[model samples]
Target: MAKARILIVDDSPTEMYKLTAMLEKSGYEVLKAHDGAGGVALARQEKPDAVLMDIVMPGLNGFQATRQLSKDQETAGIPVIIVTTKDQETDKVWGTRQGARDYLTKPVDEDTLLKTLALVLRG
Candidate 1:
């Protein structure tokens, strides 16, 4: 079977690299974008199985991108997980409202990330 493809949309180079490495090690095909607009474009073009997004990007923020992706018929079925530094309850609620399937704080746990990815993919 083919491995799942995941797009990592984050402005932080370190975060992007870490996630890519981890996902690759765990047998997931990783795609990357440094900003939200690029992320959305990639989501449309690549149609990745899932998206791990960051909220504090330079333009079009993750929440906005997620809303667009979730609402657009072409990308609506792809699950989005907000992987961000925002840890407040309000932030999580806002992400969910924006159509994120799940949320993960910065310094994402390897186990949790894998588990969340599996859960969303299965759903």
Candidate 2:
């Protein structure tokens, strides 16, 4: 079987590179977008298996982008996992309300990320 493809949307280059390295090392295909708008476009066009989104972007935050992706018929089935520095309960609640399948905080733990990916993909 072909490996799963993941779209990562983050404004931080360091975070993007780190996540890309982790996903690539785990044998997943990684697609990148620097902002939510580009990420939304890529998600709609590419229809990747899943997306890892960052909440605090310049325009079209992760919540809005995830909402768009989830509500859109073409991309609704794609799961979005929020990866951001916002670790408050409200942030997570709002993220879920926006249609995020899962949420992870910044400086993401390798094991937690992998496990969450497995669980989300399995669903």
lDDT of 1 by residue, 61-99 (tens): 999999999999999999999999999999999999999
Worst 10 residues of 2 by lDDT: 114-123
Q: After superposition, how far is residue 107 of candidate 1 from its true place, in Å?
A: 0.8
> lDDT tens digits, residues 1-123, model 2?
899999999999999999999999999999999999999999999999999999999989999999999999999999999999999999999999999999999999989998999999998
TM-score of each: 0.99, 0.99
Pairs clashing within candidate 2 = none
Model 1 reaches what TM-score against the true structure?
0.99
